[model samples]
Target: MRYLLPLLFLVALFAMLMLRGYVHNEILADHRIRPDASTDTVPERILDGGPVIDARGTGKPTSLDIPKHKLVLTFDDGPDPTWTPKVLDQLKKYHAHGVFFVTGANAARYPDLIKRMVDEGHEVGLHTFNHPDLSYQSHARIDWELAQNQLALEGAAGIRTSLFRPPYSSFADAIDDKNWPVIKYVGSRGYITALDSTDSEDWQRPGIKTIVKNATPKHGKGAIVLMHDSGGDRSQTVAALDTFLPELQGKGYTFVNLTEALNAPSAHTPVTGMDLWKGKAFVFAVQVSEHTTDVLVGGLAVIGVLVFARFGLMLILSFLHARKVRARGFRWGPEVIEPVSVIVPAYNERECIANTVRSLMASDHPIEVLVVDDGSTDGTADIVEAMWLPNVRVIRQPNGGKPSALNNGIRHARYDIVVMMDGDTVFEPSTVRELVQPFGDPKVGAVAGNAKVGNRDSLIGAWQHIEYVMGFNLDRRMYDVLGCMPTIPGAVGAFRRTALERVGGISEDTLAEDTDVTMAMHRDGWRVVYAENARAWTEAPESVQQLWSQRYRWSYGTMQAIWKHRRAVFERGPSGRFGRVGLPLVSLFMVLAPLLAPLIDVFLLYGLVFGPTQKTVVAWLGVLVIQLVCAAYAFRLDRERLTHLVSLPLQQVLYRQLMYVVLLQSWITALTGGRLRWQKLRRTGAVEAPGGIPTQRGSKENIDRRPVA
Candidate 1:
């Protein structure tokens, strides 16, 4: 049942294609002829014998069987603006009138022609809404087609007709067992099913003489001549009529409308107030559906163009970033051997507190680990104090969120450079040294560390790991080259103490304190650089629900930061560069791209159902190939395993959709001024610090090193 909705959507899209003339059934395809100048065509059959009635006659008369030289002229499949007007003029020239079998689609498009047909004393009848061969359709669909056309006829011409001529019908002889049910249904509805006696075959566009010869009836016999005023070029039919009608009149035959020729009541059917109201409503709905289908197609086209542009731009920028990285050799300026203050913000993170502090203590650079315990009920402070390590301080405070804890920790720091990390993250021994070296340039305000997922054995974790490398790290490289790096991950980032003080320390206005501070630093005229080698491994969510919550906060917080610094776009110098180049790119790839990603699925299904299968598959595979190439490049840059490519397609189908929904909900929450509380994820203790030290309950003996600031 969960799959039913997508199946229904695909079916509806296919029906729309049929309605919009993109897909046609065999009957329609067979009848559809292009109006080309070349006159070569198939010869039409000549009816020299008497008119043939249904093999199993339903007691419906084939013709008037008139004693006088009289005939009924009929046209089908029209109300065409071009050929229809010409046909009507020819009838008017000879003071003649004919019955016109009009399809609802064409009638709705050119109602003025239907009105002219009525005002000029010609007759109107029903052709199915899209000219489908009703023999193959279900009963409900056939009824719907007929009802919709009735409604359209009333709306367009202010009246309903009881005359209906099924498509693909040439004469009475053509109605057989296959079409018997449909004819019976129409008869039950009180409609007169008109059939032709003489086959004009003008639809074939044979020479004018052939059309006239085929349509001319036997001597002393009255007949109904068949022809079309729509579907294709009808000039041959119209020209044939100009010659045939006059010569027939000269031979003492009169052409009259269906009612007069049949000696039957007028084709206009009486209606009730209820029917009239219902008809008007149905007509309005059909119009809206047509317009909406067009809008959907146009929207899909726009989304395709945007997706292509995004892929192209990401490839080009990432390539340039790679070239720049290789040219500079991933080396920072001369190393700054300054003591760094590492602030580990914790809230209910007692499980990983000791491991985080131990990793910091083992850093090659001189550093003090400040584990700010933000009111953890699990004795997180006691666990840090039990370590008995040098230059490690455990500050206990009320639960004030991560930003508040970081601000408190930074205030008591005794170093010029600060490294901020999460309690669940463990850094490499050289992480601090590599992170702080960028400060050797006085203009550099902060350095963003490369974040890796440490618990990537699970499928969900693997997806997040790929995203960190292909999405986050690759984006940072592009951002670094453009000087528009917007985020410094809290997992591992280093900042100059003066730069933090200048930006008023960590901001509590957003959930993403790191991103908020980074944007603030950018606006304050400082360079935020990416330190690719400063790797920190952090535990990622292992379940879909947990991943959703974590990403929701991240997406929501990023939006807040972007909005907060929107004015930077219009500023001068570095701020303006970030606002114009960096901000737009982030917003495009982060927010807008995911928002429009659903179109890929929609178009994929549409193409599969209504378009060529091979082309659709090729196009889809082409997109996936491009993404695979990009992901391969990113993996190589991050020096990670390429086996993660096995999960890329599955990630697109599942993880990518989850991310899009998260971002969409975030947008909705931000737009509605809704407040979201920080959600603490369930810690699995799956990640291990360097030397395989699990921070669960035991593993204290792994922390043997003692270093000082």
Candidate 2:
């Protein structure tokens, strides 16, 4: 339900955009108006067919019935900067005036234009705000549109326009049964509705000659000529006026404003304080929305660029790391042969604790396994003690959490090198040896082991396996190359005891204690490296609920860790490298990328409905192809079965949304100052006992190793 609110809010925002014409209007047919048409184009004769508007009403008289050679020019949808000035100049050249019917939005934008219309002996009239077909709108909406337009006009030019024009209506003849009610309402409001007698269709961008011909009356008598100075490229309208105005003057036809042509006094009212404030508020809202839109679009563009840049860099660097690994092979420290202490922090992980211990006991390196039980009521400690392995020991602790338990384990460690493994995970026989080998470099303080998803026979597990192989592992290789490995998975990692002591052991400050500890190591000037061959199989959640809970902890804990070390970005040397390089990469790829990824689906659906179907399909397929190639490469490098690639599309459809939601929840929790507890997953114990199967693709001598599942 928490996720539902944000998703719905986003959908509603897009709907608002659609209504405002930012998104497609096909879904709301009434909001979609033809560019060149408004209610004002409706014939007046149709209104006369009913008792909609009395021809002898108090409304100002129209100029449809006029003397010979008298012309009335009316331009709708004006205050446009580009063509309005040109139109005004042409009219001024011939000493002519025309009625400018302006939409409220445009009127507010160019108040000087409205003032110029009145200043130069031209008439100003209301054309509503946003130019909707008032006949199709509700009564309240119609009222709001008219009232808002009146306020805008009064504020812009200190005049309330009584001469009104309903959008989509043209000549008095265009007023029809469909628009008669709206016309009647405006007439009731004491607004004289002006309609055209002739329309030039100048908005279609027809040649100037055609526009001139269309505007010229056949009998050279009285006519209100309809044209537009906005809503499109009105160059033809301006050009036609340049040539036609002089031609009309040569023919002894005098051009006049609507009021003079009709021989009626101006019905415009004075501006009021209330109208000014309302107009100001509306203008302020428009400005804020516009600026907000600019910022949002700019931010999205930045995020998109960062995401793709990280992908490109990681792909190249990961490829190089793989090549180097293949060519030179892994090297171990001679000192790594010393005995190591392995810590298993258990908390109600009884189902997989035995397997975890057995796997560690089978390690090729001399090691002692310390199982620090963090107040488990499920006999998790009993299970470990039942193993009775000589090198394995169990310790009890209060319910303090994983960090406290790990700290307890470190205190009991009797070796220089310490290995940490979750009680729910199993490792290969040589995993411990492989994990600590990177410490061969004295400066190397920590090793991040390759953690894989066990129990992958299920579809959910399969998706997780793919993520582990393609996303996390590939990222680790990239981080390793950049000398800024940010996390050492608690499922399997090795640390020098001295290095751990120097950083004050694991702190409970973050839920991701491993990440917190590793970052501290980096800031303390110790190099953190990745051990690709040190593979550990950990059980993944079998259900969506469990997955959500587990990820929420991981993500929230990671955020806490990042926040705690955020200042390292400005520090010197290694700390600065981790902060600048590692932190940003983690933030971009892990956090921001996932948050923005949902937009791809949103836009995909939008394109499916309102965009060119072929182009949308091609674009969507192009993205999928890139993902497929990346996944394939990651699988090849990790030596995993390529068959799992089949789930990639389905995972995108289902699993991706869940992960996005998890990240969002984590961020929300972090921002709201809400705390999240360590939520343990129910271990299914799907991993088998150590058997004679070599690591996925290694030697047969150490044949008793298997993949996570």
Candidate 3:
């Protein structure tokens, strides 16, 4: 059920985006009209017909003309908010009515205009939704356009219009072979095709005098005139109407709508019941989708800024960190060469415990390894006891959680400087030595070590390797510089025993004890720094399910840790610095960023399917390039091979989504007050030891191997 929530949310988001595209005329739109189309199939009678054409009967088609001294005024492409009301006002001033041919797209957006047209005694007609040229549309498309237009009309004004006008239509005499069939089909759909006898050409923004001249009939003849109330810059059309109405009225001509001019029945019929409700539902959906899309676009902009800001900060601060560490004679203060106590918390880690113990036993620094076996039913303690290596001891206890086991080991330790590691991790010989060097600075409390993915032979492992390098390690460097280092990895980290005592031992309040303790140390006025030279190789989860579980706990636990220490934000001195700086960075980069990162992919899909594909692809690839550059820089800093980057793009396509969903599930669990226990991943013991040497099962040959450097 938890997993299904994210999927359902995505489905709903996709649906809203699709609806937004449809209502905005961004999908399946074709607006071109062929001006030089063939006219061989057009009948001679239609070429000489009147403006009102009727082909609904089985016999010959008939056309009707307005009575002498009577003019029918028709406006196309409207119900526009800007100009349609102005045109209607002019008609009302003259106590006249005009027909408004509205496109469904515009009508749905500005339904009040349609209602205003009805309430003010104006006629509304169908101009085909989206304003597509009917001559180029299929029969099904024509039917859909007409039906959708009627639906919009029904929703807006509770009436269906029978008056029809194809987009780009002009004079009745201009009907060609390409358009004759479309006109007949429309007529068969029970609509009277309203073609123009005189065109004002106001759509071209011609001067008012030219428009009035073009729309005037010769010798007091009756005619149907075409002008526009929408489709841009209709000021000339509205001005022409003001003058044309009064001037023509003075010339003994009366203006009326199509029905009045033709002396025929009303072209609009009132609708109600299910049809009315369905229309309303459609309009409602479009409105909601439009508003939702607006909000998503705003979020996308914010995410974009956050992404760029994070990348900029990482690059700048990481360079500063590298320069500071690599500077000659730079050290974390004088090294004291103190012997450290190492703790390995084990629970059903029989497969990797021996290698973990062997690697620690070979550390270049003087160290005593204590394996705290927390009631491992798989005899994880037996594996370490069988090793019988010098300076390594296995302690057995009941199945307390990892925090309890670590606290037990801390109590039994004999060294002031302590190193903590996971049972499945193998550290380099110099890792402990390098990790403990940070403690030479009296103010330093805990040092976070560099953790690497050792099982990188598989695709999933390679992806994790990239993340560890690019996302985790690089972030640690930046955070270290900012004095707000959040987490000391459980795989490899060092702590001052005094600092540990000051913050009380590890708390079981959060699943991420590492992060929880690090924050506590910060609030207790201790410095947490990163040890880049301290590297540990650990097996990364090789399957999607395992990765999801591991990350789910990590993400949720981080949230819990953040919440647990939220009060630090209001504290004074060092605690305040970490709370204000560290907490916001963690919350942005770790939680909120991952949650909103999927918007990039969402818009990419939307653009490809709807339109503007070239721009969309370019934008997406641009983001990918930025990521690639950052990854390359991180790999260089870590001195890792760049070959693993071949899977980076694929990771963005597939693996990023998994991480996003995992983060989302964690958010859901946190918001709902759910509890999560320790989820142990099945380990294969495939991790390589320090110096890239593979660990062998039950092989004592390398137990006494000399420490490297």
Per-model lDDT: 0.77, 0.78, 0.88
Clashes of 1: 0
Q: Estimate, for each residue in 1-709, the C-alpha lDDT of model 3 and write its tens digit.
A: 8688878877888899988888778896886877857779888788887988998878777888877898889898887889988998899999888888999988887888899999988889999888888888999999999999999888888999889988888887888988999999988889899999988888888799999999999999999889888889898988988899999999999988889888889888999999999888887787778788888888788889988999899999999999999999998889859898999999999888877887886789998888898989998887776655666667778998999999988988889988999999999888899899988899999999999998999999999999999999999999999999999999999889989998999999999999999999998889999999999999899899999999999999999999999998899998998999999999999999988888888888888988689999999999999999999999999999999999999998888889889998898888888899899999999985654323444445434321111
Model 1 lDDT per residue over 1-709, tens place: 2224435654665565545442122223333422222212211221222332222245543332433577778898887889999999999999998889887777766667877988899888888877877777778877877877787777666788877788777554444556656666766666766667888888899989999999888885888788889889888898898899899999998998767865767878656687777756555555555675677767667667767776676677778877765785555567799788898888888777777777776788888888888989988788887777667777888899999999998986789899999999999898888888889889999999999999998899889988999888988887887788889999989888999999999999898778889998988889999888899999888888888889989999999989888998899987887788888877877777776676566566656665666887787787778879888988988889899889998887778777866877787788768888899988866676785333333345324222211
TM-score of each model, in listed order = 0.78, 0.78, 0.90
Better of 2 and 3 by TM-score: 3
lDDT of 2 by residue, 97-214 (tens): 8888898777766777888888888888888877788867888877877886776677667788777888887655455556766776777776767777778989887899999999
TM-score of 2: 0.78
Q: Looking at candidate 2, what is the lDDT of residue 232? A: 87
Candidate 2 vs candidate 3: the lDDT winner is 3
Mark the regions of model 1 whose C-alpha exceeds 4 Å error after superposition.
1-124, 136-141, 151-160, 196-296, 328-331, 692-709
Please give the lDDT score for candidate 2.
0.78
Best-fitting candidate, scored by lDDT: 3
After the best TM-score superposition of candidate 1, give how far the Cα of residue 125 lies from its true spot, in angstroms. Answer: 3.4
Query: Judged by lDDT relative to the true structure, which candidate is superior, 1 or 2?
Result: 2
* TM-score of model 1 (CA atoms): 0.78
